[model samples]
Target: MATLPYWRLSGFYLFYFALLGATAPFLALYFHHLGFSSARIGELVAIPMLMRCVAPNLWGWLADYTGQRLLIVRVGALCTLFSFALIFVSKSYAWLALVMALHAFFWHAVLPQFEVITFAHLREQPERYSQIRLWGSVGFILTVVILGRVFEGLSLDVYPVTLVVVMAAIVLCSLWVPNAQPSSGNRKVLADGFFKQLRSPGVLAFYACVALMQMSHGPYYTFLTLHLESLGYSRGMIGLLWALGVVAEVLMFMAMRRILLRFSVRRVLLFSFLTAGVRWLLLGSFAEHFWLLLLAQLMHAATFGSFHAAAMTFVQRSFGPGQQGQGQALYATLAGVGGAAGALYAGYAWNTLGPTITFSMASVAALAAAVIIATRLQEDRP
Candidate 1:
């Protein structure tokens, strides 16, 4: 019973992302267990994100205006816990969608603003942001691999219970996390959307690029585990493979400060997108080749790690403290819209086009992201 002292910012991220690790990779499989079709699963899974389009901003606005950041996180987590409690009743799509929408509406609210919280704390030493964030990867990998093994002989009904526990942890962490509030802190409503800040050509281009790269991940998130299962990989292996991707992400985060010092955020994103295009292409073309598949997992550092870290940096630098909450909200909204579309489309395309063709589209989308960066994104000297 020793109290955990919050340091720099990494401890919170470890718990925060560990929650994500417990869920995102496994939710699809959980839906798969509900006797739902892939398409139905996509819809169910995407509902929370789909709701994120508006929910996070609404919550972010409240946080920015009220200066009640911790309360917002607590409320979001409580709603998440309460919303999921009804999930056992979700034997059908309508019921599931309703529950999902409710939970997601709240769940999405916490992160966008909390990301701002993390960044706010890291204002002086931004490089250490990843050192803390890497714990989230650790949490994610731990959950995926352990849960994968646990699920090999078990059924999928356990997803909700596991999710609730993870979410509760997030809430607990938020309650204990102390962020310094600036004396000048006050939020003013802009009549227009953050789209104004995005009026800059480079900013717009960067946003579009992120949207594309996230969109390309649709197929991989929706069908990768099932596809691997069809290829005869066990649940345990799938979890570890998923864990491997996080491991790479964690490694990338540890080295992120050094990397950022040397390269521009735009350059990192461009490289990540290009690597994603190639990674999905290879996975689709040679999924049955295990070693090749592992190599593709290694590329996850580019697709997710570098790409995400760069995107966060861009967001952090793009807007000042006044717009921090909304800034994070905008990224969540865009990712939600793009990621939901990708996951949904990939689900439908999955059985018909097959992983080969489906993942080819992923490559195409990621490549398009790279092209957008080349044409639209121009960064000043860092």
Candidate 2:
């Protein structure tokens, strides 16, 4: 196979995340169409994401040990394609849950390893990292908008097939992706242990802050569609709004190199965490204004994009080749644990307190996250 272009790296990012954009916005609605109850949908959606806690770390270790991260990515993409395509085979809650778990099990293997691949290439230069990964945001937005428009005509019945098609494309791209050349780190160094790594003040603090941010997002992802649907927005509009957020995310990724140059990653993380609080509060308080909603979507740049990029940069700087796998695993673990808890609580909150109160809860979570970062997270320069 020919060497992959730099843009092709971006292409892979775009396609994978575009698959996310295609599904995340509409899956709840699809479950609704299939007669699943609201709480059930929330639980179902959370299951796949929640599985990230265990799956990624296991796969990350496999890649590091075998030096076969690209092969894992290919396997994950193919499994995702197959498992997602089987979504139509059964509609029972148990069966759907099983399918989602299997898909997520395979799906979760791609990201952390891919992060390793990107960093392995750009270890000496992180600026290019965002440029490649930013294509993911582009893919996400483009897919969301097109599908949003498509769903305007078709009923939600097409959700399964559409997701399958996109996921299969991701697999095909994975097949063509160029593999990473392994690094020659100290092969004998093994005593560093996960706890010792966590003892690093910077890593611990960063993980804490990230966990909080992920926690804050729980309600929005769990019930945002249901919340809006209850408020009378059509499915297409919801998808468009989702696309709008990704557009903001794309812009931020494009600008991330400049931002990092000017600002410390810790500082950026702090600001993003703070902004998330404000964003969630505004979303809770101002649900009716279309313009306000659009503006809030734009805040996704800081809330998720900047925050995520900062975290990734921090990982790359803090960990060595020997520790890279474990570093990424820890990040995924904290995110998964934090995200799952946040999403579960949000589901409960939405079930109990309704949208305004549930979203207010999310805002509170964001604020708590900001405080954790600001208080525990320290930066020498910023």
Candidate 3:
């Protein structure tokens, strides 16, 4: 712990997720303020996710082949900043869509490669990952709370500028992070071994569950703000609700080392999926009830915090050193596929089937993931 470049690695995650905090809850609202319909907002938001499908794989392969993950991270961050700045130039649907795709292409390239760098730095101390990662939740909480208040007092016009500032912070942090490499001796063997391992039944099942888990989040990420706002909650309150979820997540992260030490990763994942299923159902059915909505928000600890931590550990253990970049990239790719699908479906459903049915659909997706993990994913030590 004393020897690790802990602050550098943690700082990158802080700003990276801070960018997420700014966009995830507010981007759609900004689009709505521009008078776009639900369908258009969905399409615009999905554009970046669609880019995730292609960008991460391409960048990951390049990072693996060249062994310059940190260099790629820096370049990707700079490009993301420039591309996203184009949002200031236009409010046309086509223009915003293009900006989303362009910025996300580079933005998506940063994290998978950076994950490889962090793990390399951790080396033998992977369990400490959550301690470092918890700062990201803090960054998220700060942005969500502050911006929520800002938006309450100001216009949505400030949204783009706020994002640009966060992106700039990400660029600065990317430059500050030191590079690290995984083992190189088995490069050829590990490189060739990636596909072979990916083909195994357990790995295939796990990836499928990954897609489903993210797909289940579509309604929440794409419309929760709007949904709560319709119910008359203030922007300041909505932001706090979002922050509360991440606060639970931070607490979960603080306890994850102890939890992982006592339980299998498979168990943690199963629990996460189960809780997600329940959370979505509650949100769909009883969102008007403050206590129920609060309970659902708290379940974010299981849905994102535990699920992500366990999945990261699983990926790290499943792939070899040479395959780390590709492994993380593939994970991001699946998440992108699921998220895109979710946003598109939620957008169409939010108006047609209504919020209850739309959220129920999300619940079903989560339950299906729970089933997959229960019946298919084999038990593994954490």
Candidate 4:
């Protein structure tokens, strides 16, 4: 039996999501600080997401074919760092857009492959995944809380430097993590190919639901900080709000092993989608009410935490060991498609439809996902 390199795996997630902690909440604000319009900001922010649709598949294929997931992660991390360093060179809209595209191409390549590596490490003890993954939530919380304070006192100019530091940490952690191939003995060899498995019962619907769930997040990711700023909230408060969501996510992750044991992944996914619908509605309609906003943020536990763990389990079980890389990659790809579409539409709709309507649209997207899951996704034991 292999001893889980538990802390090392957890360390990689820490830095990997620390980079997200820096980017997800602040990157748009950074673009705003640069004087870009909402539409342009959406486009810039969506660039990486757009790259997610492409890069992950390419890198996933390479990893699966070569059995070199860790090397891909290291190369992706290094390239991400180098590409993002170009941000300091120019603030022009075109330059920033190009930089976003370049860095995100590499950045998107890291996670899905790393996810495969992480699970490969976990092997038989798949339930322990969230225990290790919760460290990522911890990383997100630390950065958001600290940087929230940091930005309050300093200029947003520090944002890029902060991201670069986190990216460097990711590179270091990638080098530290050991590679794990999916054990040949444990693999379920399917007679059908990757696409056939993808078309298997409930699989396609699940993927579509994944895309819709991400699509619903567009306004929250792209504009929630700006929205709060418009509502007279301080950057520190906004940071706390962002951290609040992940804090809930961390607690949820800690409980996920028991949760999964008690509930089917299908049930968990359905509940997640329904909770997301309500969460979006609250965010759209009641954001000015502090308690309501807090409740909405707390729903992140269901929306991302439980939903993600359940989704990973589903994907892992849906495909054979030979196809894990592509399975995870396709998951990322559809999510990218949905997220990119959401950002684009939110960018166009935000100024025209305003926050209430923009967020209501997000609510509708989430509910739509719920409906799909309730009706189309079948229960399966993992």
- Best-to-worst order by lDDT is 3, 4, 2, 1
Show where candidate 3 strays beyond 4 Å.
186-188
Per-candidate alpha-carbon RMSD to the true structure = 2.8, 2.1, 1.1, 1.8
Segments of candidate 1 deviating more than 4 angstroms? 1-8, 182-195
Per-model TM-score on C-alpha atoms: 0.94, 0.95, 0.98, 0.97
Of 2 and 3, the candidate ranking higher by TM-score? 3
TM-score of predicted model 1? 0.94
Q: Candidate 4 residues 1-382, lDDT tens each?
A: 8899999999999988888899889988988998888998889888888999999999988887778889999999999999999989989988988998898888888999999999998989899999999999999999998999999999998889999999999999999999998844322243246778988889999999999999999999999999989988999999999999999999999999999999999999999999999999998888999999999999999999999999999998888887888899999999999999899988889888999999999999999999999999888663
Clashes of each: 2, 0, 0, 0
| Top model number, TM-score | 3
Worst 10 residues of 4 by lDDT: 183-192
Model 3's alpha-carbon lDDT is 0.92
**Candidate 2 minimal-lDDT segment of 10 residues:** 186-195
lDDT of 1 by residue, 59-150 (tens): 87787778777678778888888987788875688988899889888888777766776766666766767777787788888988888898
Model 2 local distance difference test score: 0.80
